[model samples]
Target: MSGIVFAIPGDIDAPTGGYGYDRRLLREWHEAGIEARHIALPGSFPFPTEADLATTERLLAATAPDDVLLVDGLAFGAFPEALAARFADRLVALVHHPLAMETGLKPEAADTLRRSERLALARARTIVASSPTTRATLETEFGVPASEIVVAAPGCDPAPRASGSRGGAPLRLLAVGSLIPRKGYGDLVEAAAAIADRAWTLTIAGSPDHAPETAAQLRSVIARDGLADRIVLAGAVGPDKLAQLYDEADLFVMPSLYEGYGMVLTEALARGLPIVTTLSGAGAEALPDAAALKVPPGDAAALAKALARLIDAPAERRQRADAAWAAAGDLPRWSETARIVAEACLRDRASARNAARGFREKPMQDQRAREQD
Candidate 1:
């Protein structure tokens, strides 16, 4: 009776990082003996139509007043007013990142999402940001109280160590993320172009379906630079295939403009792959400088320089990969994540029940004091 009612906007089995995290957490929580019920709220997400909003309202409205409702910020961000009127007392928000900060959104759309997200987050009993950076952003930028937010960073599962290229030519580079503007796939492609003269092959594994236009533009960039033959857009592979890529790769690269928590970075570490990534959002927090060659976000020149250095120096790549392997020991695993989230839920429910009990006893205590007086 005291379990989570987890809700998401679309297919929970989707291959994106957010949905991946969701699927992994649910599996972990269930393994830990938490009876979590999942409800899929069908919609396009962060841009839900009016009908979608109505559907969400009904879905939430059907929950018992005492039921614990955990909403993904994607859904809540779209229609906060509905949340304000419905499930304020027992709502917990899982925020990947503030929707308003997403790249390619217009000023007015961003403004509207910002206001709604801030208000919706305020209505939740507790909010869990996916990274410390995200937690800080929610606290400072969104005005959510520091005490109300929890930083339950994404978890990593163990994988086989990457058997690298063994100090040779044609260095293999792997990047994973959806082909979106914010993911900076275009920047990554442009950077690879600078080092086209070198012996390297870039394989970008992501879902181009997320943003076909961005994916098309990324292809255009590759074609324009005449490196189309060198870069391969292996659209969204399975875990087995991804793990195989990690095994086959000499280095891991993610040129994301922002990440709530760079799940792919942790994934790269799980395989002990050397990384050349931008120090944006949670990317730096995911891997240290000794473990990665970090560059400035959106700077193709700097990204290219980082990539070229690693490509040229096999010993340096080995050293960085070794450091990453060592540091991978400190990375939080899925069980730990499940435990942290379960404890938070249990603690929140305990507090809510204690408050309710105290409220029930208050009148009796007052009457007793009056009689004595």
Candidate 2:
């Protein structure tokens, strides 16, 4: 087996869904006897410095021509033309989400990002998207050929069933995702305020540092709404604590405006927690109709109403939790996710090798024909 290098631009174990996926996939692949390894790049992705570019050049230059390099799109999608063209031959892009589509970017800046990503992705032999929704966007919006794109959704680890907020306890709501503008956390706060009359408390556990200003803003909102006690910003938590939160919680709610795959939703499902999330990006696709109550993105009023209804109906919540548990049985495992990506990369490597051989042979055949004539 040839080398498999994951060229991620930050810590593989970062407290986020995409990083978690990369870490799990690489670990699983290594366990399955693949020559998988991680290569760290500059952490300041999507806006790397000159030193970062220099490091990338040196690293790619050192990679064996036969080796497969999987570049996380956070860094790869924003690569300049020269950097991208240098190692384009064997590069495979792991696109968690399109950088251009993230919220809070100015139109001009978004266009620039779109252009750069298109160029960067054009060099990849194939783009492995986290979901079908992302794959479609790659083909239609980014001009990537449909044949050059693949979809491999994230996997979920099975978790202890949630104990549920029963026995006259206040309904517990959990929303997980990094605190960024795109996640619609403001909407979540508003929705929480709307349901202020109900017996519920909300916990948002995510990487507050990912967007510090947003975190501060959320704190301000919590204070302004007089929900400082009711709404707790748990900040970035470890796996053990997160699982404990899940086990103790009653409901999973997310107001994200978009997601590449919304791996947390699957995690929520794995724990048999009924969900109340907006129908946005892959989050909508991952959620089963029976397992969740879906609402449009940015509609705090509707979100609040949904929460209120579920709070009043204990039987319905129980039924939905049961449905979520049933759905968990069929969720993809980490091993399967790793196998899919490994197989895709290996398959394309072989195809590229065969095509190169055919190209080399074509001239000889043409010369033989000329001599016969």
My TM-score estimates for the predictions, one after another, are 0.91, 0.92
lDDT of 1 by residue, 264-355 (tens): 89989867888988888775665877889888889989999999999889899889999988877666766556555555554456643533
Task: For candidate 1, give the lDDT of residue 207.
Answer: 92
lDDT of 2 by residue, 217-258 (tens): 999999999999899889889989998889889999989888
lDDT of each: 0.80, 0.83
Query: Candidate 1, TM-score vs. the true structure?
Result: 0.91
354, model 2: CA deviation in Å?
A: 18
The top-ranked prediction according to TM-score is 2
Q: Which stretches of candidate 2 lie over 4 Å from their true place?
A: 347-373
Per-prediction tally of clashes: 0, 0
What lDDT, from 0 to 1, does candidate 2 have? 0.83
